[model samples]
Target: MAAPDPDPASAGDGPGPVALVIGSSAGYGLAATLVGLRTHRMRGLGIAFEAPETGRRTASAGWYRTARTAELAAGADFAFLRDDAFSDGVKEEAADLLAARFGKVDLLIYSIAAPRRTDPLTGEVHHSVIKPLGTDYRAKTLVFEDSAPRIGALHLPAADGAEREATVQVMGGADWQLWIDALQSRDLLADGFRTVALSYVGSDITAPVYRAGTIGAAKQHLEDTARALDARLGDAGHAHTVVAGAAVTQASTAIPSIALYTSILHRVTADRWQTPVDQAAALWSRLTGAAALGLDDQGRVRLDDWEMNPEVQAAVRTAWDRADTDSISTLADTDWFRDQVGRLYGWHVPGVDYETPAETTVPWPAPAGLGVTTHSS
Candidate 1:
């Protein structure tokens, strides 16, 4: 397909400000891409690892969502490289793609969530674990068992030996730093450019499994990387961490503990609930607004301000005390949780016909002829 004409109000005649979004399929990455194209008025280059449509098996939700983003983009340039963002040569190919379509990227959003990662240089594979750091973590986990919302206690063991290190390798901000390094090395980053890595730091109820878990260790590393990158920008760009709210992401259902937390979080948050897309818009707004990015005492972006409200947490804590097998349905917004998850797969989407079959295969634009990276380095 021919590329859409550049938006007239661009930084240059080359292309409108570009957004290079890693892990741009479902959840926060995809939502950020929407904000980049719509609010930031930029071209999009999304990187993801969705398997292509097979004979019977269809493409992943990331694939479908990217397609929909292109459709709704209307006269805006959008392309997706169905590739792994964690490979050895992935960054080079991304630079090449950006060079071909949009010159320097103004925004880089890293929102990848995966089970494992590989050291592109050594080819050593590292897997991430969901466990507490020091001791056993006992939390009231909720799930829809056999169509009914139920709560139960989950005892997550601590990560031992190299488990914490491996988890950090898999989920930490190392790759994010590498990405910025690559972009900066090739002069692919525009002046005043920005990059953000999404993370979650919930209340103490889920801290052991989340904020204080192996993943938490990784997030700390991410914040450290952000601090370094911010200094490294040298007036040309900015890098930071964004703590997002709990939402029904594509992977949330698999983690029973998170599912329960989000369910109760939804109830406590009530009508002020924020979706993945809403979070994206909020992040974008902060990025583009005149007031500088608000930083907490620790110097990190806090997009989860609404979620961390004392009133909300207080109510959630009260509900936490009453959250039992019999009270789950009443205490948590189970219906909303389910509906949000459904929307990920084209279900519960407004104006979409659930009873009919739709086209499942669509070609993604490849201006640089750069294809996807299917395997780890």
Candidate 2:
């Protein structure tokens, strides 16, 4: 839980750069927002769809994280919008807000991961699935039952043509393109405006259900969009697809294979493992010309270098091969994986009093009507 070191160079007399982070309540989105606010001293606007706490039930983790982020950004200019990013209305609202509050956007980070998306143009809803294309996929996956991890076999049927297209529509870069178009039309994009979209390319162990699956198709579409955007921006700005490493996030837990692979990854990497925030710090440095831009053959940023290392992949493969119900605990870092998962929901965090009955209703700093919840600091 170590914080990233602040960059002294970013301190200046002028107002800092303005950043717009879509899906900024959790995962890489949240990490990127923190890096912009904490390290780069940037003004930021975060967009996310999250639920507030109701009676007996707790608020979504993103809700709590957003509140904490607002608390942390006490002195900075920051705001969070709780709305569906896929809708035309929210897009217009965000654009208007940026024009009035920030004047221009220097950086735009697209890191949304949603299961369903409604097409703004056609009013069609697309639901994304995590199945393989053309053929069935069967693999050994890790499942958590009754707070315990167990190995299980998963057999997923192939996605049909319609389903594959739907998956791409929901998870792909179409929405990212739309967002850029929206901002550009409003003339709110600053000179040298930079944009990045997060992506993943896991090891061979989880390729079938990840990089080679229906989700992969969507990611490929996203990458293509990035290239198109790069050319469109030309000298005015740049766009890139940042390939991130596997880590425990809310989305990853839903995918059985990824959960298993990440558990083994944590074991293999151990102390060397980097969290999303750590990667975001490095990314911020690269984006600001403070660090070398490690671009792959496709001219995209590479944050998965550690996870894709030869030795790391080999070890993961070895463990994945021998993984089963009995040997999983020995082969993978299940404890670490579980702990990370709990932290996503504001649980198992150190220095938090779980026994105390804290306030469940916490309000966002701006944009009234979005209810709130309390989270332990």
Candidate 3:
């Protein structure tokens, strides 16, 4: 099949700016892509797991597909690679796809959140588990907003010996490094480009599953890699990491501690009327703008700092420490959690029909990057 011609007047052509987004299906990555699409007028190359579904399922109907279709129809160019980023072969194929379509990428966004990784060095597969490290941990878990809460215990499976090290190596920065190295070696990375990866650091209550967990260890290595990539970019381009504000994503749902964290966050943010996508848009604006992201005294991007404010964390911790299913919080009770979940599937609009089938078959412009092919559910 012949490739579509590059739109000379595409939105990204003026600044020579185009973004390649890993894990662009939903959550924060989708949020970031939305920002780039609407605010910065940037074209993107994306990959998502939902590409295989033929039916317009809720999970597959989010902005990744919706926005790509919209952009292509608008004469903007994009490519959606439906493959895992962890494998070298898949990454190479994706790179070739990009090269064939757009030739070079000026920005890269890494937002992958997987539960396990197969370690090449030790020849072992490691599954990520979440649990509190402290003795006898208990918290209130919300199965549904306004539904009764339940007391829950988080038991993380412990790993020892080479497995632990292998877990860190496989789930950590090595794959990220591989992507960058391959793109650079093939000259697919445009000069003066930037790359961003997402990270999180929360309070003691959630630390066991987040900041201090095995996943946290992987994040530390990610931070280290960011610094290394920045140096590698030298004077022409740069790389950095963002500790993103807490937002409920499919990835977050798997973490045991996050249920409580998200519940409390909903309780706190209910009255404020700000969405995670809102926070993401604000951060992406700063990151891709002419100005540099203002760093903290520790030299880390301070986006998540606001989410971890002393008063805010205290409220969430106290709520988790003092509630059970009988006294659990609900969306009707909190308003915030309800909104977040509604936005999750793009069904919370006032006049939209949440029960009826979605209009996933709406026409979108077909781009050279993403071939026009229908997926099966």
Candidate 4:
């Protein structure tokens, strides 16, 4: 989508909207940051944990993406904190930076997806797992054989009680709540402040391993927390759980059944699929009164409307049923799926020369350590 021209009148003697985006290095978080800066003309801070290039290894894709974002945000009020968002130290540091720089935050985007979390309160660590709840689940999963995509049946054992609890602890809404409370404690939330947490509700085909799985349990807690947070914000602000559609992200590709499901879904919904940036643009339009807020029954902003269409789902179901090792290539769009994955890591992108030796160590524009604060003017 083309970015709208910034309106000088909107900056009336001050900055535009101020946003605090957690997990902003990649995926939805990165998309939201770009939309906020380019489309909405908002000034913001982004927080993420990423590693720089070592002796010979290249920097994380997120690092390069953030550097590109910094380049795009030239002459805009923005900064980035490369540290753990879950720690109290980083939270306090972020709060201080926001207070000093922007005075108030108009929006908060929480899209963190981590494998493990260390609780600051009790010093306990929790790890998340991707397993079903009740009986064992067996399904046709996609795998790469000799760099070629293939379909095979896979068995996944049920998650134990402790495993379920641990997953919830790691992926649940507790961290989001903590962030809100921290900002509230510092009186950093502006009037009409809004917050959103990204979520997904898959189709019945992958329910056993996804929506009805342990991660789903955590998402349930996340949605519940949003409701509670909305009530807590009352007249001062609002909170919502944005139900986004299936897409190939670094986090989504790691899930067991998502790759296969997304492949088939891509084939079924060819030419109509919405990337993360598209969804972020639509979301910005809704949030900024540029478009209608298409809310679902549970008060969620439904960006998955096309993905959940009856005919599209029916086609996906048919593809899933007929998918086998012999016909998988024709049944699913595995090539497109592989390309998306490659793009995530800064590879296979068009107009880029892979034969040329490029700079591997890219510096973050505004680098912040644990408790340091740096800003780009």
Residues 100-218, candidate 1, lDDT per residue (tens digit)? 76788888999988889988978999999888888988878766667677777688778896999998998999899999989888888888899999988888777887778888899
- TM-score to native of every candidate shown: 0.90, 0.94, 0.80, 0.94
Full ranking by TM-score: 2, 4, 1, 3
Query: Which stretches of model 1 miss by more than 4 angstroms?
Result: 1-15, 350-352, 365-377
Task: Write down the TM-score for model 4.
Answer: 0.94
lDDT of 3 by residue, 1-377 (tens): 01133334333546435788887767777776666665566665776655433454433554345555455336556555555567666677777767766778888888877767665446566665454333334444456534434556555554343544554675567777788898998998887788888787766777755666666777888888988988888986877777777766667777766766777766765555345466666566567574558776644666765567787777766776676665564422434545555656664557767788755654333465455433232
Global lDDT scores for all candidate models: 0.78, 0.86, 0.64, 0.86
User: What local lDDT does model 1 show for residue 175?
Assistant: 94
Candidates 2 and 3 compared by TM-score, better number: 2
lDDT tens digits by residue: candidate 4, 1-377? 12335545432445669999999988988888887887567776899888877777877888888888878877778888888888898899999988877788999999999999999999999999999999889998999888788888889999999999988888889999999999999999999999999999989988898788999999999999999999999999999999999989999998887888999999888899988888988888788767897888888889999899999999999999988888889988888888889998887788889999998878876734323453221
Model 2: lDDT of residue 258: 84
Candidate no. 1 TM-score: 0.90
